[model samples]
Target: MISGVTLLDYRERYSTKVYFQKRFFTVYIPFLFWSIFILFYSLILGRISISDLSFASIIDGIINSKFLSFYWFFMPLFAIYLSIPIISLIPKNKRKTIFEYIIGVFFVFNSFLPLVFNLLKIPYNSSLYIPVLGGYIIWIFIGYYLDRFDLNNKSRKIIYILGILGLLLQIVGTWFFSYQNGYVDQMFKGYNNLPSWLYSSAFFLFIKENYHKLNFKGILSKLISLCEKETFGVYLIQYYLMEFFILVLHFDPYSISYRLGASVLIFFLSVFIVKILHKIPIIQKLC
Candidate 1:
């Protein structure tokens, strides 16, 4: 939704070059800085040694760090920002065709192609040029297309019903996959899975349709303002915060009580950490 709004503004008010350039500086530059921070944090903890710290190692950390696993999202985000201009070029009339094409490509590359390759014992890179062609591409396109119009009452009702049904399917599908595998299976947890894709689309549509009805005042409004501004930073760092809670404090992995307590602690800690980071003049950009 945010991307769609930004893209619409770019199309109406800014030159393509300016839009792309701003994204590179605003998005990629911060990502690069935080990625470096993650790498150095790993090194400080002896996750890697001086012998492992070659120029290639640094490049690899920037490209592929095992310790900072959440950084994996950055590659796709960078790719998406770069591709936005081209994606936005499709004529309004042709959007439906483009949306359908993207959905078809997702199924072909993410679902069907993988099955074919595995059965044939073929090897391939699964990242698919990072975010540009990954499973989340469908959601990106769907959000963009949905942002172009206001859904009617009937359409909203349909989407809401589908959303609930999809959520149920997602839960059941995850359990089924886990049972079949005799372990926890993440096939349904990802954005690319059919159940997740459907659920996410419907949920977003429901939100977009009803967003106007939500009213926040006083403390709620203030909290929302802070979250809207700082959620991206929170996202970038929350994984590490949770890890810290688990590793340092020894939060019980199996106890629901411990998990709930740790989650709340992690969230508030993350908010405080980001707030402090944002106060630093130089680090503010990265935050």
Candidate 2:
């Protein structure tokens, strides 16, 4: 969604330096602040001992997002942001064809072929290496393509149905494999996989198609805008709030009821905290 939204507002004439500067302050600064904050919070909660702390370890934690598992998202997100200027440099007339070819390559090699190899129990070792064309960057192009083009009703319906099937595969496949292994299987649960791509694409299209039909007005719209502004800040801090619930409050997140309640509470609490932080001039920029 971030990539799609960014593309919506992007212009080739925009200054790369200014764009990077804004992202550095708005995204990276908050990431750094929360990384350190979470590290200290974990320490205070006895999640890690004093001996585990070192300058090197701290740097590694921030760089690799080892402090909080969810923080790993920032690294790829920043990478994508860094690539946007280059992405924007693609010739306007040739962008559609180039994006299509690249997306197809990503689908075949990075997603489809890997799944096929894994399912067949094949020892997959590809000599063909295209690091820049692989990983979550595909999503960036996918988002751009989907936003730029309109799908007909038939196409949308097919995509929606496939998305439903993809979701079912993730749920059922994971449960089956996990039951056999006696542990949760993460194989079916990553964004880079086909199932996730289908599910996410369908969801994105659904929102894009129907958004105009929905009524958002007055205070409701303002509230929605406020929430949108706080989203990144909330994401940066929400993991620690969840950890506090699990570790300090002993909330069992595995329980459906507890999960729902905790999620709502954490969301509102994080929003409130971010809202308060936004009042402070310097602190607001960091978060």
- lDDT by residue for model 2 (1-287), tens: 55745753466446777787888888888888989988888799898887988999999989997888888988888878877778887886787899889888877777777777877889667755357775588888878887877778898899899889989989999999899999998767889887898889888887777775653555556767769878888898788788789989999989886678889889989999999989999888877
lDDT of 1 by residue, 51-74 (tens): 877887788878874557778877
Clash list (residue pairs), candidate 1: 76-131
Error of 1 at 200 (Å): 0.7
lDDT scores in order: 0.71, 0.81
Deviation in angstroms for 138 in model 1?
2.1
Question: Which number leads on TM-score?
Answer: 2
Which residue pairs collide, candidate 2?
Answer: none
Stretches of candidate 1 off by over 4 Å are 93-135, 214-220, 253-255, 258-261
Best by lDDT: 2
Candidate 2 local lDDT, residue 146: 76
The list of candidate 2 runs beyond 4 A from truth reads: 7-9, 128-130, 216-223
